[model samples]
Target chain A: MSTEDILKQTPLYQQHLSLKAKMVPFGGWAMPVQYESIVAEYDCTRHGCSIFDTSHMGEFFVDGDAVKSGLDFLVTQPIKDMPLKTCRYGVMLNEQGGIIDDLIVFRIEQERWLIVVNAGTMEKDERQFQKFIRPSEKFANRSAEFGKLDIQGPQSRALLNGLIPDIGQLAYYAFDHFDLLGANVLVSRTGYTGELGYEIYFSWDRTPELWDELLKRGARPAGLGARDLLRIEMGYSLYGHELEENICPLDAGLERFIDWDKDFFGKTALLKKKDSLDQQKIICFISESRRSPRQHHRIYDQNQELIGEVTSGIFSPHFKQGVGLGFVKKELAKKGDTIYFGDDKNKLPAEVVSRPIYKQGSLKS
Target chain B: MEVVDHYFYTKEHEWIHIEDDQATIGISEYAQEALGDITFVELPSVGTEVEQFEQCSSVESVKAASDIYSPMSGKIIEVNTDLEEKPELINKDCYERGWIAKLELNALEEQSKLMNAEEYRNYLNTLE
Candidate 1:
């Protein structure tokens, strides 16, 4: 059988087809890559507003004490201190300190919590959670019961306020249950794009209704193509690209999200590699032109010696240039260094810059 | 979709408009549509000799990269420099403004090996 025949479909599959979306296999699901043109959709998301079907992502509900349930030690972040209605971003690691998946923990209440993870790693993450959590604690994979929509861009607030009047009260990284289209659902002021955005989790079957209502409210439909570009522009780490099984959070430049004050899973292994001299490094760069560096593209130093490989790349519509994330040696990844991508036959020059290549985004505004 | 009449096409989806010994080359609309949004186009340098059915340039989209093949053996005399800055022109107008290069043709008889407008349109249907 063909790959598409075996691939799963989201609830919004028909809606995407009606909009002429180019469906591509992603994370075991046949998802839309683009509705119209990728650049046009990207422009709409940056300057106006766009809604994306993020239902492929997985969500789980864990009920018990943070420490007693073993949830605190399963992830590399401090969960006991997370206030109600707030979200914390961190990674789950194996015994060897390798990243299993980067996820978001939402403290719904003092005892109830929600964990959102990548679609590709959902099964593996579930096995880890199931093995670690206490037998008395309740664990449920609610991915099939829910559908997610990411309404992103600067104009998202005004658009959402039309439907949910109290949306403005929720601060960044905070979530609350809100009534939408007669269903009470979780709505969070969070997004992957570096924009003032919100993510809505509604019933799976009724998601098409919500998607239609959002489109009817003047929000355009964007696909994973534009979403990838937006996230790359923000220097966000993708699961398969930046975070991998063999790569640790520290190597992925995510040490800031790790809490040293709290004891967590993989702490011992992570501490052992922390002070090592040859720890691998991840860097972000901006291309001199529109030519983008693709994943697995070779990264070379000024003298033409190979140093690393690109992990994620995109042609940034906002910056009108190519921006990328790559891994290089610790000694060669200094800021303001000129590096080249691609092979010797055709090398493109770029500069190593700080994280978040596009700073003009209204992320905080 | 938009196959220019009187133009010859290669199986690779490259369209060649031959006028006497001078020819112009561009990707077909079908090709551009399949590529989605074009971000960059590597234009062939001027005065480079290219063989028939050989890669002369490349186009990059948001998804992937693909090579553009020459339909006939020729010397690349001129290239569309505008594509360097705005590659989306190929997605917008693949037939006219998106033309990749103009060549001084060396083998005129090689045109018989390519498909005409009707045959190319039929060829595209097979792809679907």
Candidate 2:
């Protein structure tokens, strides 16, 4: 509550307060945690269409050739294979291979790219880009000038098609600029909820005008509470949680995103660490009971031996059971291994299955 | 929030309905609403003895896992096993069908420390 004076407010801050949202300090911002209830808001995102204010996320524009601007070597995922108007998910890493942040690079123009990063690591990510980006290339951190909104759920496509006629043509991981309400907005067919949706980046100052329009279109306002739950159910990686400065992409189960075929930042470190012994890898689990695995809760084996720690967790409303993502010793992280969460006082039983505990989703649909 | 007039309440938001030496216990409506979408309930054993205001069983909702304290000291007589697979009953009917446990009162005088419906209503206001 004391941080209210210092925390930055988005353009829709007043609107959120008017709706009686439960505001919380997130990533140094006074953001809405939930407008109604976390569960109700989550249900809307899964079944019905819901709009989320994600303007706090970072966006930077780069104008130059991929390799010439030093963008290719900066991220782990390969950029040469991406066609125009497509985006790929990857991570920026430190020299020691520690994950700086997970991001999406959208190749909008032939020589231009739009990169989106997490809200918590925006400043640090910008500093890294400014440090590595070479001369003769144009770069702009337009995070402050862009307001992002994600409309997600099974009903998202139909609702958005009513606004943008060509929304159906935009494939997953693709984007296009369109004139909407007399404003040029960048709409991407990508979302974190594992649902059929779009992430719209609008002009920051005039976004509230569009937010009002979207509300009239029957998109209920969801909050960060629902967003977190949705992403967790899909076993998605969050910056501060699954992908931290101390954690590497390999340990985070994101090696598939890394391009070993091409040389990039932290390549030598990654190559060396790949063969290192005793490395812990991230794994997803489902609780036998309804006891949700909370952050920082230690993970133990069936014998009560300590293995690792839980990074993200929630009681999945879709599954009617607890689901969580955690990092455990790679050797002990088996598909059917029974894991327990909690410390000495107690241990909640769970089983390590394949990644993504929630099987029912409309991500690709 | 639904508060039974005849029930005794605790500061931790648990309620108990006493009939002779037998008592039924469950979390209050305010508690259920606060911990939305109850997912799992850890029912206490039948013969366990519990102290007033002490930890009896725990319930996990989508928001959090909270300790359900004993409203008054007693020996657990029976538990609602139905809650194991139908924990949403805590959210649907927390007062009646969602009752957690039944206890045989060991010390009837311990009830004095609890609040009546009127007193509990006032205490709930102080929380806000």
Candidate 3:
């Protein structure tokens, strides 16, 4: 059989097809890349509300003590001190200090937790959890049973408030269970897009109905294409792009999310590599024009010497130019540094800028 | 899907409209549709010589970048400079205003190697 025949499909697949979405294979699932033009959807996500089908991501339920169940030692964050109904973002690392996956830990209850991970690393992440936690009915991978939708924009709160009257009470990164479509649904005030948004998790079978209702409620449907552009504009790291098993969080400039006060899987190795002088760090750049720097495009210094490689890039709709993230030698990873990207024959000049090239987001609004 | 009748097309989904010895070239509607939204177009320099089926210009969309090959050998006489600021013209009208470059033909017989509109429509069917 062909590889496409074995790919997984979400409950909203038929809905996306009906909407004339362009489908593509991503991380073992047949997902929608775009419904209409990416620029149109991107504008709606920034100025208005747009709903996204994020069912391809993996979700896990863990129950027990934070430290005794090995959950505290598994992730590189302070999970034990998290308030109930709040979420924290961090990474899980291998023994050698390489990142395994970045994930979000949601404290559902005093002893119960919810972990959300990338779709590509779902199986491996499940194994890592099972291997560490004590064998019991305390852990379960519910990715197949749940479907997720993100309604994001400055107007998202008002739009969703019509359905859930108490949605406005939740702070950023906070979550609560509410009755929707006759089923208990978990809704969080968080999103990948740099906008006011809410992520809703519901039963897989009911996702199609949820998608339809959102569209009917004036929330335009957006796909992965717009999602990628939104995240890139916010300087967010995606799995297999800005992050991977071979890259550490510190080098990715995610040191703020790492909890150094606690003992974790890669704590010792990360400590030894902390003071390394020649470590490379992730840097952000803005192109001189609409020409974008693509993945694997080599970065060049002022002297025309190869310095690094681009990991993620996209034409910023807000900035009206190309912006990207790349890894470079620590000494060269400075703001206001001039760099060039692309091949020797077509070296496009760009300026290194601080992260989040589009800063005037409604994320905090 | 929008193959202009009487126009000659290449296997790579490019179309050429010939008027005597001068020919205009652009990508087909199928090509533009496959490339979500045209974000940028790197047009070739005017007066540069190009060979048939060789990469002359390149186009970028939100998804990826693709090389636009010349349909017939010639020298580039004119290019659509409007695409520099508004590449979406190609996505909006891949057949008419979206024409990439105009070439002064160097070979007339090479047109025999290309497919007519009807043949190109049939060729697009095989892809599906």
Candidate 4:
């Protein structure tokens, strides 16, 4: 069979087709790349509002005692301190200190937890969870029966407040269940874009009704193309690019999210490699012009010396330049360092800048 | 899908309106639609000599980049400087306001190598 025939389809596949979305293969699923222009979709999310169908992502539920079920040790964060309605962002590591997946774990209740992971790594992550989770623990993969929609932008709060009651009360990274179109939906004050937004998790079959209602309420339909650009602008790490099986969280520039005070998977290995990180380093950078540096593009210093390779690159609609994340030699990963991308023949000038390149984002507001 | 009747076309989706010795060049509407939101256009420098079907300029869209080939080779006499600040004109109007460059035609015989309005439209149909 061809690629499209073998790829999975999300619940909103027909909706995307009806909207004339340009479908592309992503993470073993046929997903929309764009319904309109990518730049317009990006602007809608950053300035106005946009809704994305993100049902391809996986959701796993585990109900048990944190310590006895080995849930605390399976991830690299302090979940015990997380409030009931809050979610924590962290990674799961292999025994050798390699990243398994970067994910968000929601403390839905005292003993119930919901884990959100990347769509491409869902099967592997499920297998790992099944292996590490205690046989006595209750574990279930609810990815198929769930549908997700990311409503993002500066105007998202007011728009959502019109639909859900007391939506304004939930702080960032907090979530609550609400009634929507006769169905119970889990709405979280969180999103990938640097905006004041919400991620709505509703019943899989009822997703079309939700999507149509949101669009009817003036939310533009954005696609994965715009989502990738928004995440890059915020300097958020993406799986299969910034995080990999051989890439540790520290190497991916995510040390702050790792709680070293607690014992977790790969603790000994991480400790051994932490102080002696002499080779690998990740850095955020910006191109001097609109010429984008694609994935795997080689990074070089002013002296034409090889430094690193680009992991993610995008033509930033806000910055009016190309921004990217890359990994380079630990010594050369310095702020304001002038570097270049591509081979010596077509090297594009760039400057190493601080993370979260787009500072004007309404993410915290 | 706007194809100018008086213009000659290339298989690469470039169109040239020949007026005596001077020819104005721009991308087709089909090309602009495929590109989806042109962000940057690298216009060729004036007084630069080039061959027919040679790389004349390049464009960067929101998604990817593509090169524009010269429909007929000649020295670039003038370039659309307005595109430097506003590349979206190409997406707005690929025919009139979005012209890429003005070339001093090398030879009138080169027109025979390009397609007319009707031929170009039929050519586009084959692609779909």
- What pairs collide in candidate 1? none
* RMSD value for candidate 2: 2.7
lDDT of 1 by residue, A1-365 (tens): 98646988899999999999999999999899998888899898889999999999999899999998888888888899899999999999998899999999999989999999999899999999989888634888889999899999999999999999998898989999998899899999899989989999999999999999999999999999999998998899998898998998998999988999888878899999998887879999999988898998999999999999999987877777788999998778688999999976989999999988888887778
lDDT per residue (tens digit) for residues A1-365 in model 2: 47436888888999999998878888778898888678888988889899999989889988888988989988999997799989999999998999999999999888889999988788888888998787734878989999999999989989988888888898888999988888778999999998889999998998898889999999999998889999988889988899887888999999999999988888898888899995889889998866789889999998899999999888887777788999998899698989999889989899898867777788888
B71-126 per-residue lDDT for model 3 (tens digits): 99999999999999889999999999999999999998999999999999999999
Error of 1 at A176 (Å): 0.6
lDDT at A303, model 3: 92
Lowest lDDT block of 10, candidate 4 chain A: A130-139
DockQ metric, candidate 4: 0.61
lDDT of 4 by residue, A156-268 (tens): 88887778868889899999888888887799989999899999998999898899999989999999889999998889999988999899888898899889999998999
Distance (Å) between predicted and true CA of A196, model 4? 0.5
Kindly report, for each predicted structure in the order presented, the TM-score of its chain A compared with the true chain A: 0.97, 0.97, 0.98, 0.97
| lDDT (10s digit) by residue, model 1, range B31-127 | 9999998999999999999999999999989867889999999999999999988899999899899999999999999999999999999999999
CA lDDT, every model vs. true structure: 0.92, 0.89, 0.91, 0.90
Docking class of 4: medium
Q: Which stretches of candidate 4 lie over 4 Å from their true place?
A: A2-5
TM-score-better candidate, 1 vs 2:
1
Please say which candidate is ahead in lDDT: 2 or 4. 4
In model 3, the Cα lDDT at residue B14 comes to: 93
RMSD of each: 1.4, 2.7, 1.2, 2.0
The CA-based lDDT of model 1 is what?
A: 0.92
lDDT, residue A106, model 4: 94
True contacts kept of each: 0.62, 0.71, 0.54, 0.50
